[model samples]
Target: MSPLPLHAVAIGDGLTDPATQVLTKPQQAFAFGLVDEKQLAQAQALAQEAHDLALAQRYADAADKRSAMEDLVPLGARNLPEA
Candidate 1:
């Protein structure tokens, strides 16, 4: 028998409905210095691809693309560890 398909858990729960959530933009990171436009463009492409994959119900692939896009950007100061 085929195994059951696995899906990602919804973004929020209970009080927050996933359907009501609106994504104005994809993930973005703030850098301490100048950021590369080429990397930004690449990340944007990945974001669009991820959105398309999610719409096609390829959740895992979409998440992978999102992770790749995230890796292109540096973490913001707020997310950095203290020295």
Candidate 2:
């Protein structure tokens, strides 16, 4: 028989959860010396754009994986007959 499948898993448990995801906006603002109004606005905008792009990419990837699994389920089911 073939060896058991070893599925890859994320390192951290809840740390990767959306609720716990880190917000680098404030930190970026502080790093960029956001004491001035203009600078603060610019930094906040940049951070927001970056965060949105990252979230979009994550969702796209998840959808792609889910679509791929549609094919895998039938094959897996075929491997196991009724109990």
Candidate 3:
């Protein structure tokens, strides 16, 4: 016989309850500095562009969004050891 669906067991355990999935702790942001005003502007422009792109593609699938979101990470957080 085919194995029972694993998700079937989870249904009775309040797995779908919104309260059971409440956040105990949410992430706080990390702080950093940019190299200069030019870099800061570059980062801001990148963010605005990403925001606009997401807005324009608001109906796109989640996988496309996951790909689009890689740019959302600030450059300092990405390439620098610390910033």
For 3-81, candidate 1 gives per-residue lDDT tens digits of 8797767633332421111121232332333236676677667767777777788878877877777667566522322
Model 2 agreement with the true structure over 1-83: per-residue lDDT tens digits: 99988898656333353311323333433444433465445544544544555577765544343333222223333122111
What's the TM-score of every candidate structure?
Answer: 0.53, 0.33, 0.34
| Residue runs of model 3 more than 4 Å from their true location after superposition | 1-31, 58-76, 79-83
**What TM-score, to 2 decimals, does candidate 1 have?**
0.53
Best by lDDT: 1
How big is the positional error of residue 69 in model 3, measured in Å on the Cα after superposition? 11
Candidate rank order under TM-score: 1, 3, 2
Off by over 4 Å in 1: 1-34, 76-83
Error of 1 at 68 (Å): 0.2
Q: In model 2, what lDDT does residue 25 have? A: 32
Model 2 regions more than 4 Å off = 1-24, 27-34, 58-83
* Model 2 TM-score (2 dp): 0.33
Q: Is candidate 1 or candidate 3 better by TM-score?
A: 1
